[model samples]
Target: MDNNLEFKTIIKRSFLDNSKRQLIINSDYIQFEDKDLATDYFTKFLSSEIKDYRYGVRWIRGAKFTIGRDYQIFIRNNENKIIKINFKSFYGINKSLHFKNYSGILNSLLKFYFNKIASDFIEKFQNQLEFSICNVHFSDKNIMIETNSIIKKKQNTILWKDVRTKDYRTYFAIYSQENPANINQCYNYKDDWNTAILNTVIRTILKNKE
Candidate 1:
């Protein structure tokens, strides 16, 4: 079977007195032929690994689980034809009074965290069945620069000093055919960031058709 997959990251930021940020990372859509096996494997995997990495899992009413409060995973059976699983993670930063260099730092942290999770998934399922990861993309960073504070109509409002938004788009295709060689090399990297980048690059290559 030909491989086609994609994942995306969406980032939103507010640059006001109360600076805030939110990030959403989504995995490539996956479909499993054996619903029972897929559910069991993922459930066990999350139960053992989620908490170890500062994430909590909540069993949401039947066959649905929530990860880290904002992230959610659930299974849906479509008339017994196929079973669909959706997984997503959300991270947010609240506004703080103290000035801190958080935008770049938090962005890197979020990327690292997302890559870690992806690596874990690959490690677990690479040998079991066919899977692909590709189309690496990040939404345009939305930033608002606070110009000045003013009282308007008896209300306080901050004027936008500057606003900018743009998308970061890249394409790469990876497939299970190049498994252990490509993936193992990435795992062998001593630096975490290097490992993440290599893994992502290899996956993108495999997903791409020459």
Candidate 2:
């Protein structure tokens, strides 16, 4: 990836073939004993915290709620305890896609909406348990790359090569370490968000260089 490349151009090319771009939030090891109580708790939380945030809640199954104009949240359960919360937001190509500081804009978007939601949930349950939070920007596109050719030299990203298809290749993922957080603070900040993403991209490219 070129540092000088415009972010919109990268997005445009990444989705040129109608690929999907997603913002994903994963809350790991959430510890809530009662499922009903957990659902009831979040229902009230969403109703109160997101009333003015312009999000509508659509209940899907038990403890699963889709909020916001373009996002969904669901509580993952294990042995009757709520284990994790998964949140996702999708984006399509639109007028706001073009911006000079795309990284900055994304940072603000995540902090203003996604992070805020996750932070609220963490704070609400901080006394019950401590957990790890991870945010990911996932891009799916059609490409041709050799998986065997890739040397596993990087820790931040990975590429997947499809053997069944001649053309439907994909880069499997890019991710960072889990960000530790507590009631009063989270490790992720807007100041280093862009840098973290850029470094991940650079590391991915360097690892896959021909």
Candidate 3:
């Protein structure tokens, strides 16, 4: 990869043959363009202009076949302009075709979003005593999550010692390590953009604790 790497990709803008877009990503900037319209989708942005960002990845496999390879992302720049990229391609024979550019795009995208920010978020937890994103809340010693209690709506407070994660190819779930037979809750990667970051933050913190 050079200073800037470009890839031809599809932007999920309805079911059409020309859902094409061009992505140019570098260390400090990104440019997404509508190849069909010859106009900008996410015109361009510097690192400082990024206000909020989230991404999700899904690679499902079984036996000797691949089921799905999907990548989804959204970024909101300082101007409040947002750009979305859903690279699942179409269904059937073309479903996983978008994966051809998945690795390269995600590697660069992770560097763009995670570099230093991971440490920054960890630091925030250290300073403020908590961290929250995408409606998931974490504390210094436990994770507070929503539970399915039909009687009264409440959150399930799972201690760090009991918090166990399970990666189910297309989703992630947390369960009590003491009783792993029942999953507490699951977050589907395709639906939750920040699932990757949440996984990183939790894993990193767990490693430090260990």
Candidate 4:
């Protein structure tokens, strides 16, 4: 196989389809071990650390597929948000994908696996997954109320987003991808590497002002 042509082909295939888009729901609903825990954690973060910032949380995945200690927070639209998420992931994917790392290939959507982490832990079991809430008002029946882009489906280069008038947010925690050896070959994890990946997504969203 011509390495150059193969690489290009891989890139094209991996690229999101421009037209085929759907709300790939990671789960129907988030379940918390204790409902109060969710409320408490939210209260603490919103009050102290994130008090000044606007509203955005970016959880960077470690090499092991776990949440890293160092997470990025955004209040107002800062340049750092964009720099850390999208661009980095694109670069990493370009390099790692060609290596035939199963993790890398399968990780295009790891929410499926990440959800598994919450299953065994009681503390985490109670926390909720990210959701895009939707509502319709009587005055404007035609207006869309809420939609979140937690899980996106795309066709080639085309992407479609759910447009309801509510906030789209997900509470994410990652685990390292090491122990789960079975999935490692395809999807490897590195500590702090995903900071760039998360930043890449943020930057992409920012560029489009979404």
In order of listing, the candidates' clash counts read 7, 0, 0, 50
Model 3 regions more than 4 Å off = 1-15, 35-42, 49-71, 77-81, 87-97, 178-183
Q: Which is better, 2 or 3, measured by TM-score? A: 3
Instruction: Please report the candidate that would top TM-score against the real structure.
Output: 3
Candidate 3 per-residue C-alpha lDDT over 97-177 given as tens digits, one digit per residue, 9 for 90 to 100: 555565666677677755556667788777757777555688887887765656865567778888887777667787778
User: 1 or 3, which is superior by lDDT?
Assistant: 3
Candidate 1's TM-score: 0.21
User: For residue 152, what is the lDDT in candidate 2?
Assistant: 40
- Structural similarity to truth (TM-score) of each candidate: 0.21, 0.20, 0.71, 0.16
lDDT of 1 by residue, 44-157 (tens): 121112211111122233235432222212222222222222222222233231112223322333343445656654453434333322212211221111122244222112
lDDT of 2 by residue, 88-113 (tens): 22232342333332434344334434
Please give, for residues 59-92, the per-residue lDDT of candidate 4 as tens digits.
4477767342222222212133211111113324
Specify the poorest-scoring 10-residue window by lDDT in model 4. 132-141
User: lDDT of model 2 at residue 59?
Assistant: 26
The stretch of ten residues in a row with the least summed lDDT in candidate 2 is 162-171
Cα RMSD, each candidate:
21.5, 18.9, 5.2, 22.1
Candidate number that wins on lDDT, 2 or 3: 3
lDDT of 4 at 136: 15
Q: Considering TM-score, which of the candidate structures 1 and 4 is the better prediction for this target? A: 1
